[model samples]
Target: MDTGMIIQHRRSSNIHSLISYHAHVGAVTSIAWNLFYPRVFGSSSADWTVKIWLLDCFTPIQVLDLSSPVGGLAWASSSSTVFVAVTDDGRAHVFDIRLCKTRSLCTQQIRQAHWPALSCVVFSPFEPVILVAGERGFILSLKLSPNLRKLHKEARGADEEKLKELERQKMERIISTSAIS
Candidate 1:
């Protein structure tokens, strides 16, 4: 299998290449940037792996294997460390790096008997819900439980800068811990 590569370009500087990531052993299926962190992103692949990466680092900070080809992935709008991935096996996998890095927090089948494989996933910007799209034009919306979302009461009162700082710290902690392990 050909190794999947991700090339980063400087968006403003004449579209020049800035960095390259050798992400997976199969085609890269999807890429999603963290809503709160400019430098953090995640990529899913046909090789059945989803990897979280930092712009300055060549290596992935964390990797999750789904045991089936990943169709697509999207970062949660409410949290910097949370994301959801859809797979060819008709399931949606949710991950929160703060809660666990080695395995998904939830894996639920979204495709029914006659439905096609899931092709993409997107989190709602205003609510704790996600919409998964299947290859055959089927779209399903799922509401996330409070535990999966981890929405704190304090976040409502916190200023944007403060919330961003907290999120940055959370991501930093994950990176530091992953490096140690």
Candidate 2:
């Protein structure tokens, strides 16, 4: 078992790296397996690229290269085709992975999202909201416009009421840990 690669455990207390997907040239910065779509996952690397792959296969479905290294990636918890990737140059990109016609380009991109460097990008489980964190402890919250139609509106404050509701929902979860951490 290669310790540096991602492994998944399904339906049991067993862990395994299903395939040998050496998807990056340099250090892999982040990996995100879609919580809802079991077959899909995303990875970012210091090699200046973001790669998306499917389970049971070794090669990435698509790769997006940038001028700077990518340090963070996350799949949208609510959508089947949406994901976010952050670069070391302080930019966060929103991509519709299903857009195979142009996998090298992003559907929407947010630049200068964080000073120094952008570190992470995460999507809300319930709403079209994104949270970003980076250098100097700078944190930002942006709500995707209707249906993720707009990524340029504004990086406003979070909605306290909705966030509280989501927290309440999580408090009700009752399950076992059966997957990769």
| Index of the highest-TM-score prediction | 1
Candidate 1: 10-residue stretch with minimal lDDT: 9-18
In the order shown, what is each candidate's alpha-carbon RMSD? 2.3, 9.9
Find the candidate with the highest lDDT and give its number. Answer: 1
In order, the Cα lDDT scores of the candidates are 0.86, 0.64
Show the lowest summed lDDT stretch of 10 residues, model 2. 171-180
For candidate 2, lDDT tens digit of each residue in 67-89? 68887898776545567888887
The reply for model 2, stretches above 4 Å from the true place, is 1-19, 100-114, 147-181
> Would you give me the overall lDDT of model 2?
0.64
